[model samples]
Target: MNTYLQVAAADASEHRTLIITLFSVFVAATLGVTVWAGRRTKDATDYYAGGRSFSGFQNGLAISGDYMSAASFLGIAGAISLFGYDGFLYSIGFLVAWLVALLLVAEPLRNSGRFTMGDVLAYRMRQRPVRTAAGVSTIVVSIFYLLAQMVGAGALVALLLGVSGDAGKNVIVVLVGVVMILYVTIGGMKGTTWVQMIKACLLIAGTLLITFLVMLKFDFNISTLLGAAAENSGQGAAFLEPGLKYGVSTTTEIDFISLGLALVLGTAGLPHILIRFYTVPTARAARKSVIWAIGIIGAFYLMTIALGFGAAALLSRKEITESDAAGNTAAPLLAQNIGGGADSAGGAILLAVICAVAFATILAVVAGLTLASSSSFAHDLYANVIRKGKASDREEVKAARVSSILIGGVAIVLGIFAGKLNVAFLVALAFAVAASANLPTILYSLFWKRFNTTGSLWSIYGGLSSSVLLVVFSPVVSGNPSAMFPGADFQWFPLNNPGLVSIPLGFLLGWLGTVVSKNEDVDGRKYAELEVRSLTGTGAH
Candidate 1:
């Protein structure tokens, strides 16, 4: 890794030129899209849901882009390069999670929701309290996820600039925060969707190209490639097995299960992903979008195996560890090596392009997250809750813009303080929160006739509080030598992820609160109406 860094330093001038040129082109293209989108964004509907005009396929691409964050593109590959099969586990969990979204959440969410996940949750419940709870959940999840993306942006930018300091990273975080705020506040969902679509195309194309090049080196032989990867990994056949990273002990095995549960349930609850459903005109369109997203996202993850193994096979683990210690640089370094080493024209160009793609991935995702957070704040909190649903369209849009600025500012501050924390782990924590806090409430609202305002509030607050508290006390926070704060060992929780406990707890809280509260026939009637609409798409937005 030091050797690679030394080589990068030696060719800093060329790398700088290439990066600048690629970044300039990327910025120009995305900026043009934002301007065009801004022109079309007139009313609150346009700002929040792209006027509900996006085609299923287009929305699908955007969904893929939103789901496949820098963590998926770079962090997973890096994990695989370092940890082997355990890394691929994340890919499987992410893909399977879409099944939950498609079959259970997509059409119903689209049929009942207007602008945010909070919309759907508050549809049959007391509007103000439910929306307020959901608004808080949305903001919390978005902030955590946004912090991860911004930190990743900082790290990727620092790598590309060949700079090694907090100052450089802080600058990058601020720049990303500003760009994301601009994307959301100016162009809204229309601009954000287009940016995501473009980025997804580039991301898929780049991944395919890298996979093809790697296969070409092994004569397109799968067996040969696997053999080489296993041999080169220094763990021999063990590298191809599952227990190398995640299943070594009883505690780790439980943690792995918790992580898997979170990933599988989280997608349906994520505000950014859920809001994509509202971008389409019909429930059928939303369902179709999920199918398309599944296809694209599945293919992307399938190819990641090759990317990960290729990195392990071609580059020594020691060098990769030396490079960044977390293997986040593995993919870029692999591109550099397989394209012809850092000094060669092919290597330099490939590295620059990959860096640009990484930047786009971060920018697009952060924009979507900022939009989701802002929409929840403005639509659910400001417009509906505080204003009693009397806020004008223009007022709501203005609120969304202000919320975007505030959210971006908060993310920048958190990212600066986070400083080099693992992106994948942070993302998993976000998922755990979403699963624990939002998914249960959403499920009950859509399917349970007895669910009331009290149930919804309890579920949201209970799940949110439990997940956050558990994570803070879990091994990820402290106790172990590898904890984020190794010096403070206050961890009493056993698992790295709280989903195993918190998800069930969320459901239990909802059920208990509902059963214990006084019965409301009005809520029952509302659920009956919601049931019909959710099933048949009548009166749906």
Candidate 2:
């Protein structure tokens, strides 16, 4: 029952110092890579899409890095450790979401857009409004996703450094923000892509190693691992079955469905992930990258079962919860235990390595997010909307760099307040907003010829506003002990996630906006051109 291993006071300082030093070295190495990549980034194309020089496998690795965020590693592993079978649902929903991206969005998005998703939406619609809406939606979604990565960084690093107070976590969050801003402004897509590829490889390797150790701990028998997790989790048989977490009440069940919907549909709409397609040379390369990504991400997610259950089997519930209430520290703590517990030199080294990988994960993800949002601002709103697409490449790239700083600042502030929520849960909010605002308009634009500016504007703004408002009033924000503001009680919406309601509303609003529009500003010729370009990649940039 006392499986929660703690370092002796004398060794704790030594462990903390080692972890910090190793982590610093990794950060410095990544920054050097970014600086080197920045030297090659000389144009708008290079800044926005990494010169489109990355091969399928490289881009796929980068995409895997972007998708397998802090939520995928720290959050989901923790979720599994704490909630058992219900926790595994997050991984399932996340992995399954990629199929939707591969089949419906990836190739077309790559073939159609140049720099940003706004490019595709603005191609046929009124340039200003659609691009503006897209830029706004991209930034909003990116910030939401960024919060999870940033918060995960705070929780993980705080635990690694043996800094128990909010002050230390907040400082780490700010440091992460500053570092990510540097990555985006200096590295652009080229730097960001390389960082992501490295992170992805490290993350997968780390996960595999831990998984192997966990299996070995149980003599490589999965059933044995599951049984130990069930017994050790304090939930007995229920820990291995449904309703341990989400099905406790009718409201919670509906919330689970909403969360599932968001996770399934959100990836296609995430600006950072979508932009990775543009880093490849051609539409075929984009498709190939996705296939590679699916394989990497799939394998990594499968190993999360071992990581999660391993933590449950090895660490007590109180140990996991007390480390961090949301269980974000479970993965790193699990690593410590399997590496010979806290007192051993092996435990300290392994813990430092895994946490360093996690820190790198946060940095890579946040940099991608900042780039996506800042690129949307520079490419869509500033160049196209404000300057009517006449801005020089240098000017636009400069604008992106400037905007990245601002966006990074906002993410840091929001992340400090959102430290208590689960990173995976925060990502679901991003997903709900993306599924509501971005995905509906994207699908309509690609498929429906009648989808015009009115439809685009309506769906985006309606979906964005509805989903955000619902979230602001939902239990995730307030009304519950686990809320962002636990003392307040403003929740009126029953579900924790808004995807179930806002997703349908988005599609319906798009149709209604087009059908009822009196302007009738349909650009038939442009639609035909877009369709041809999207299908055959004849005129694709």
Candidate lDDT scores, in order, read 0.88, 0.92
Question: For residue 75, what is the lDDT in candidate 2?
Answer: 96
Which parts of model 1 have CA positions greater than 4 angstroms off? 480-483
Candidate maximizing TM-score: 2
RMSD of 1: 1.5
Question: Candidate 2 local accuracy as lDDT?
Answer: 0.92
Instruction: Please write out the lDDT profile of model 2 over residues 147-247, one tens digit for every residue.
Output: 99988999998778777788999999999999999999999999999999999999999999899999999999999999999999989999999998898
TM-score of each: 0.97, 0.98
Choose the strongest candidate by lDDT: 2
Sliding window of 10 residues with minimal summed lDDT for model 2 = 1-10
Candidate 1 structure quality by residue, lDDT tens digits, 346-384 = 888888888888889999999999999999999999999
Shift of residue 115 alpha carbon in model 1, Å: 0.8
Checking candidate 2 for backbone clashes, the offending pairs are none
